[model samples]
Target: MASNHHRLSGAPVAAAVDSAAVRITGLTRSFGNRQVLDDINLTIARGEFTALLGRSGSGKSTLLRAVAGLDHGTVGSGEILVPERVSLVFQDSRLLPWLKILDNVVLGLPGKDARGRGRAALDEVSLAKRESAWPHELSGGEQQRAALARSLVSEPELLLADEPFGSLDALTRIRMHRLLRRLYETHRPAVLLVTHDVDEAVILADRVLVLDDGDFVQDLRIDLPAERDPGDPGFQHYRTTLLGALGVLPAHRTKEQS
Candidate 1:
C-alpha cells in the first residue's frame, strides 16, 4: 500500500487483522557467497492479490520458496510468518501418472472427504467433467487447472504461484487468468504470484512489485478499477510504467517508457 519513498498515498486498505498473513523482515538468501536476496522486507496483507514481477533470475521465485519452507537453509536473515499448511503451484503440473485428475487434487486433502472437495475444485475450474480422466489425457489448460485445484484443495492461507500459466498458449492463458480471478475472489487467500509478464500482473494483481537481482526496484499499486479495460488511459499508464520499471520499452515510443 506504500511506495519506497516512505510516503503514504492513502490509508492502508487492509487493517484490523490478527495475523500479518505473510510477513518477511530483512529477508536475505545466498548460495555460497553469492547473495540472491538482500535485505528484502515485504508484508503481504490477508486476502490480497499481489504480483511479483521481474525478469529471469530476479530471486522472486526464491523468495516464494523461502516462505513456503521449501528453500531450507537458502534463506538468510529473515523472518517469515506463514501458516503451517501451505500450498504452491509450480510451472509444471507435477501430476501423478497413474492417478486421475480428481485424485491429484485430493492428494492434499484429509482422509475424511477429499474426493468431494476435489470434485468441487474441478467444478470451480470448469474441469468437473475431466475428473475421471488421467493426467495424461487432459489438455494443457486442463492440466494447469488440475494443478491449481491441487494447490487450493488444502485451502492454505498463503498461496505461492510461480508462473502457473506460463506454459499455456495465449487464449488459454487469458481464460486461465479469468478463472484465477474468480477463484481468488471466492477464496480470498493472500496470493504471491511470480511472473515475467508485466501485462499479466497489471491485469490480475491489486499491486505489483518489480524486483531486480533480489531487491525491490519498483513498488506500485494498480490504482485502476478492477473492471478496467487494457486500453483505458489509466490502465495503460500503469502498464507502461510497470513495463518501464522492468526495463521493457513500448513498441512505438521513441524514448524509453519513463
Candidate 2:
C-alpha cells in the first residue's frame, strides 16, 4: 500500500487487483487544537454506492477531502489509498462563469476526442443542447447538471460528492436524485456521497454511514430494491435508523413515526 505517516497522499496504492477501491487506515485530521477526524478507518469496494450522513462540522467533508487529496496541512498519522482516477463534485457547480458549458466540461481533458466525450457526458446528464450556454445562463439545478457532466467526462473510477444537491429546491433535488441514481447505475463507479439528508441517503446508497463527533456511529446496509419507494416499509425502517443515528429523531422513536 502507498502509505504516508503524517500527510494524506493521493498516489495510487499498490494492492491486490481485487482489493477495495478506497482504503483508509488510522486516518486523522486536525485543525489547530480541534481534531476533525479521529482515527477514521474505512473501505469502499468497487462500484459501491455509500452515503455519509452527519451534522455540520462533524468531519464528513473533512474525511472526503482527505480521500480526494484536497487537504494538505497537518494530517495526523494514517494512510489513504484510492484509485488514481477520482472525480469530485461540490455543493456549488464550480464552473467558471466565463466558460461555456461545453468548454467547462472538457476543460483540461486530454485526447483529440475530448470534445466528443464531453458532448456524450453532457447528453448523459440531459445537458447536451445547453452545451453552448454560459454557466450564468442555467438554473441552479441545470448548473449542477453541467457540473455532473464535467465530473463524469473522464470516466473516473471513484466519485466523491459533498452535498452536491443541498442548494436545490425540493422538486429539483428529487429530480437530481433520480438523475444521479441513473448515472450511478450506468457508470458503476465507486461513489462516496456526503449529505445531511437522511432520506436522501436511504434512497440512494447501497450502504449508509452516519458520522458523529469525528467517528462513524452507524454503518447500515440498505437492502431495498433498486426501485426504492419512500413509502415502502423497508425504506422507512432504514431512514428511521439513520435519523436516530444523526439525533434528528429520538432514540426511542418508532419507525412509523419517523
Name the best candidate (by TM-score): 2
Model 1 lDDT tens row, 77-190 = 666666554678888989998998888899757877889988988898889999999999988988999998888887777788999998999999988888888888888888
What does the lDDT read for residue 26 in candidate 1? Answer: 77
Off by over 4 Å in 2: 1-6, 9-17, 253-258
Candidate 2 residue lDDT tens string, 94-153: 999999999999999999999999999999999889999999999999999999999988
**Model 2 per-residue lDDT at 161:** 99
Total backbone clashes of candidate 1, pairs 3 or more residues apart or in separate chains: 0
lDDT of each prediction vs. the true structure?
0.78, 0.87
Which candidate number has the best lDDT?
A: 2
Minimum summed lDDT over a 10-residue window in model 2 is located at 1-10
